[model samples]
Target: MNDYENMSDEQLVQLSLEDQDCFYYLMKRYDIKILRYIKRLTTISQEEAEDIIQEVFIKVYRNLNGFNRKLKFSSWIYRIAHNEIINQYRKTKLRLAMIPSNIEDQANLIDSINDTIEINGAYENLEKDERVRKALAELPDKYREILVLRYLEDKSYDEISDILRKPPGTVATQINRAKTSFKKIAGRHQLNTGIVK
Candidate 1:
């Protein structure tokens, strides 16, 4: 068994500085995560997502020394990924798709407006998943990004703050506002908001 497998990110980073091979461990650790993140944030196919992941890791490698130890390594990596995604968007004007895209079982979206939008069986028959996807697609980039980070990626407020470079308070505010906007969109779709009577 290789002790490298158990080494912390910081440890791997230090070792990587001494031995280029150690950097591969860091890339292995985050390859899938970065790929999924890119896929979620862009409508690009898996092939394109893979290419983006390569670019993200390359940037990570080049800027490895610039990494801020004060932040969670994962957060810093994600910030890099986020910036790369934005750059691609600027060039192509692409947008993110819903992640963990189980419309049928989307707990976060459902739970957000579950109070006001009761999902009765009759309403549930109205293709709620498609409706939710549409509503999410309609959301502005900032709102969607927060929801994805908090819900899909399952990141903590502090982690989100680190990645977005926003205060936790601001992240919370954005989430609340995103939920409110989502509720309005869901209502418009008539996904059985119970108020459609």
Candidate 2:
């Protein structure tokens, strides 16, 4: 049994190219994260989302040699998933679903955003915060996606930049803008949330 868990993504990529069995480990590493990301972006049934995931994996396998070693493998994979979602929306006219599915993910996202925006006790009563949820779903795709990448996914600025194919400066600016937009929306919705600056 190979210590696939101990191997770096780059190492796994190389091994996967030579032995297709190694690719299974790579897919296992990313399946759930990518699925959640897809769900975050669109309101699709589980079967539909699984189909999209299969397509992403197939594309990743085909483009394995094109992977840029300079980028973290996770970032590269996410970029692929992002493009695939956009393509699916274009092809099928799927409605983008910015609201997270479950309360746990919603609370986690709120907690993470609080790390930057200083929301007071938002996570504690997240289940009751329909206004906050509405505010999030109302955000433009660019802002919502940026927030999901930065807060929910816990991606660093550089990682987000690579994943979104944007410059690092732009990534930082967008995150700031997203926080501001969320604050404004929260205010308009009369959310019982407290934001410190």
Candidate 3:
């Protein structure tokens, strides 16, 4: 009967430490987001992604006492999930792929990229464009994951820096480089319907 929805992540962490049931709120909050993050970073099935998420939540709970309140909770949790994803890839040698399953999500990613790169597009029509998706998959793992974190996941530079454990300048540079790489790939795929600059 607690209004867990009204509580911030830090508060939930504190409560969860004292009352384990409160941990469910934290898991409930990030479960889907972390699952999608795993799926976006690799060609993993829902079952596999869910398994990774379970592991992520378990790690988060175990490390709750060590959670740095200075950092945003979302960033901290994502850092754990990112590490787990890397571990999974190392274990399974999964094909690295960025899977933006939702049409709206894909369009939002395209729009965000367009805004960041100053592309001259009002309508990208990327929802039905397999080439765009293919272009995304062709990017290097670093670039693809950065794009997902920046655009799709809507993480800020500092948040990304924390999640990736890179310097803020490094995250900014990687994001810029990722944008350039994506543009080049999109060009090769003839996806410049309204791209500019």
Count clashes in each candidate, considering only residues at least 3 apart in sequence or on different chains: 0, 0, 0
Estimated TM-score for each candidate: 0.85, 0.90, 0.86
lDDT of 3 by residue, 11-36 (tens): 99999999999999989999888888
Candidate numbers, best lDDT first, in rank order:
2, 3, 1
Query: Which candidate gets the maximum TM-score versus the true structure?
Result: 2
lDDT of 1 by residue, 145-169 (tens): 8877876677999999999999999
Where is model 2 more than 4 Å wrong at Cα? 119-128, 192-197
lDDT of 3: 0.82
Determine the backbone clash count of candidate 1.
0
Taking every candidate in turn, the Cα RMSD to the unseen true structure, in Å, is 3.8, 2.5, 2.9
- Rate residue 93 of model 3 by lDDT: 78
Deviation in Å, model 2, residue 52 alpha carbon = 0.5
Question: What is the C-alpha lDDT profile of model 2 across 91-188, one tens digit per residue?
Answer: 99987877777677777776666666655444446443566778887788899898888878889999999999999999989888887888888777
Against the true structure, candidate 2 has what lDDT? 0.85
Q: Considering TM-score, which of the candidate structures 1 and 3 is the better prediction for this target? A: 3
The candidate maximizing lDDT is: 2
In candidate 1, stretches whose alpha carbon ends up further than 4 angstroms from where it belongs are 98-122, 192-197
